[model samples]
Target: MPAQALATLNPETEEQDRRASVINELEEDESVDEVEHSTQRGAPNTGTTPANAAAQPDIGILPSGQTQPSAPDTPVAANVDLNDVVTAPESELLAMQLDTLPMPRPAQPLALLGSEVLPGTSARLAWSPGIQIPGLSQPTPVLAVNGIHAGPTLCLTGAVHGDELNGIEIVRRTIYDLNAEELSGRVIGVPIVNLPGFQQGSRYLPDRRDLNRHFPGSPDGSLADRIAHSLFENVIRHCDMLVDIHTGSLKRTNLPQLRADMNNPDVATFTQGFDRMAVVHSSGSPGMLRSAAVAAGIVAVTLEAGESHRIQEHQIEAGVNSLTSLMEKQGMTSRMFVWGDPEPVYYDSDWIRAQHGGILFSEVDLGAHVSEGEILGYVADPITNAQYPIRANSNGRVIGMAVDQVVMAGFAAYHIGTEAEIPAE
Candidate 1:
């Protein structure tokens, strides 16, 4: 199918088809092993393990032409008592036989804005803070999937800017694809954080406010503030880590990359967990969710993938795989996930903007490597057919670019990530 045609298809339909195709492919691959162990929902008893475990599939070769690391040896049954395992700290529990240990009893109902979600189940709650028009009194949807086992909570938020649709789909698949019965930690997902803006296909709220710029908001402030406050205080504050998914705004599209404050030890650990995606070290702007979460001592990072207003399948798959890797790194799951390659880390990036208004045509695609003074694209006058070449200013990788379309003078056309740096914590 043509790329344009695929973009025009119903997003929900496309996602369903993608999911089915992935399942079919997995089923056909004899090398892939099925996870046979199952745990009882809402049971305080330790989960049961498969009598005979299956061998994990080989993860193939790394980008450097080396074989990927082999999976860890299957865990042997431990002699420790189930009661001790249940009461032990999470770090110690991870080293023991997890499946053979009993889960800790859920303490209390997880309270939210206007609802309470119990453990061992999922819920779609609503958050309405009394700000509603007559016909559009719809409340913001808050989805939660609490696992039967006791572990850290990971919050996945998407569509902070309403028009960014890739994250919404990423969150949907991440929550839906997870098996709550076998899950260890709790996952809270807010797929569409800016509902009003999403309804109008706008990045900003109706009141002309950028929802993302007003994080850790005030209860008695503007509409954006109230919404931000409700989410930060009621939902985000309870999380141990936050992954705010996003896409390029306006006319730009990004390569699958992660941005976080690499200076912070906790944030660095979380950022490194996305083994297959590129990482850009950045101390996020103040009032941004990542910045606020870090200030509140919650490990946080931002994922930027694809373009806005469309669901790209490859980007979605990348996002899903990154999240899965994160789950494994945090010991939230026992599943063995091996990444294909270690993505390069870039310390700084620069945007190449247009010098004159014209029709823009990109000569290179996202992730293309370019040297200083190389032509990345061209801008041409629609009537006179006069053209001007846009060149890279530094040796770097094309991390982001605008779609082929009419552009104005000084508009951001290409983004280059330069100065590749050693991975740091």
Candidate 2:
């Protein structure tokens, strides 16, 4: 199926504002893994904010070759920093400030990919009359065109958890701006895939089912199970690739990054095509959509972005740019975004759990660096007010840390990066 013609530009100021206002702080966030960037800002990402997928297919998606930058140039933070200038009541803060930012134009799909090598069969296809959600409903799905020109069917999903809504915004932007004229393959986008959870502003579904844990579900099971089952059989099985987008849980944040099966070259290639974004290896869950896709012989990966329950511009851009980056990699589109060099750090991240239940104090922010045996934070008894320090077990970076001060003994404190084969900078 051919991608429909490009829609006329209808930039949503509010949406764009949402991303811009938050991007600066997020970009400079010390916790995230840094990537060298040529442009002023990084890329965009997928689905709704509520909460959180798939498969194994053959001939994993691999890039023919990677385009290397002249040098790994880490652009310094602008001298006129947005963080220093923008001042507002915390409640009235904006998402991103991208008015002065440059953009990557939509490349002629055929010209960018070289039509000679693109799939000629016109395997483009799309689903029909997608159901709509209740709250925050604008730019209805009917007005949207989710098309795939050729090659394979890929699904970009996000906001399975309500608070994790960055992916949802990313998907929305993709649909609003998709120019079908240059598409080479099928792309299915599920922005705010978990509408019920998203509307409730919670991670779990309205019925309290963890959507990620209920995949390949049963029609006769819980509501989440049925939906999961339907998605698996009806939607997931049809795709050649799957990318799930996410953010850190409430008050938590992640740098723009990807998690996929490193052993599978295809999956690795797809993950790497997301230029300027860190790639982390993961063992997809048995019930996960990534695992489901893997099992179905489809190559899939999880694209993680900034913190949860809040929208950030850089992350949304990161999500969008990553997909487009893959489009460039797959020769599906012509537009090539000039991006930054990524500081790709590999780690088997581990959680630093609170040793004893109490009110807690955290010193470092998410994306901060740490050394082995370093103190992550401290826990204090509420009644007794006894403080105990929690320390790291190994040297690595802090990808995420608890935002709330109150803590429980089992609650995770610091999500620390650990031993992995990080590509040298």
Candidate 3:
């Protein structure tokens, strides 16, 4: 999608304010992650805020919670930093920010994808939409871990865009690091939903359709729709909650944050479970998986991490920590995850675009707080050596930004999460 085509450029607005497009952060093209971004600001909110199974042997776990031959593997990065990225809030504050929702008590076994995942066991199942893809028709890998006790079924979906590697890593780390014996309900993970896209390193399906935009799809529709329908029916329906993970797209990067619909009470409560994670209110696009899931009476949110294509260890670690904290809050796991400082909930956001095409140089980093009219970066024309500064239109933090690279005029240069407000103490 062209950068110029994204912003709803207002002709009446003056030049100073017109430099930044005041779009509802959630409105985005199919090429980018559907969840929009903004600058970050405001006080921390404590209260606010903001699945499934299958089975097989050899690729399955015993009741003793031992790993099988096909257990999900961790990312193969030797120097990856596994430390907690965000600092913990004060002890008193942590105590006040308790789990707002009661723990679910699901005692029955998890039945999914034509197989039963018994309690205290894990399994790697094969899932397919039954669509023929020539040499790439193999069923996608699905990881399921059913806990011994009772709780909610949490589903984690990654690589919805295929090229977003950070989400895949986050899912893998969260699922495989689980101890079924110590868990309450269940965890279902699909690290790669768009298998063809992942294989080809493309963001779209073989039909060039954005798979993320087709959700709760129809079997009679296009290929993307069929696959979406299959996954939604066979996997998503089984989820008590869904975390559709993603990363920045179109040569952009995002701060690790939760894009949720704060209007939904259940979703708002769910957003509070993550520790030290920024929460951005994005009602979501019509066909988006997150919006579709919520419409189907399931609490869902999109976890936007780092950029696509490359796997950044810090982003992966931050995502994993947030998930662990969420599970711990939900009573699904006994892991002693530390709760971090409360991040503000952003109700609005804006995109600061470049006014001139040139080599972009960022003056601020991701998550940097900025006042309105502050210089975010500059675009320097190589031909005439003219430099144009990009300034913020709102007081907020830099939640997303394009990396230092050549960019065309009107490109989204900085996304600020504005109008930050916290839940009452």
C-alpha local distance difference test of each model:
0.82, 0.64, 0.85
Give the TM-scores of the predictions, in the order they appear: 0.74, 0.63, 0.74
Candidate 2 regions off by >4 Å? 1-149, 422-425
lDDT (0-100) at residue 73 of candidate 1? 61
Q: Cα-based RMSD of the predictions, in order?
A: 24.3, 28.7, 30.9
In model 3, state the lDDT of residue 117: 88
Q: Predictions ranked by TM-score, top down?
A: 3, 1, 2
Kindly list the per-residue Cα lDDT of model 2 for residues 1-425, writing each as its tens digit. 11121111123464345445546545675743443232223222322221110011111122333332322343555568555755565534432444445543332222111122132312223322123353633321211232334444567777767678788888777655556555656566677667667777889877787788777777788877776786677566756788888888756677677877877767765666677776666877777777777877888888888877777897788788877777777765677577667546555878788879887788776667788878878888978979999998888877667775777778887877764654321
Cα error, residue 77 of model 2, in Å, equals 64
Residue 258 CA error for candidate 2 (Å)?
1.8
| lDDT-best of 1 and 3 | 3
Q: Rank the candidates by lDDT, best first.
A: 3, 1, 2
What lDDT tens digits, residue by residue, belong to model 3 across residues 79-129? 756684644567557666665546555466788888988888899998989
The alpha-carbon root-mean-square deviation between model 3 and the true structure, to one decimal in Å, is 30.9
Report how far residue 263 has shifted in candidate 3, in Å.
Answer: 0.9
Residue 43: error of model 3 in Å? 51
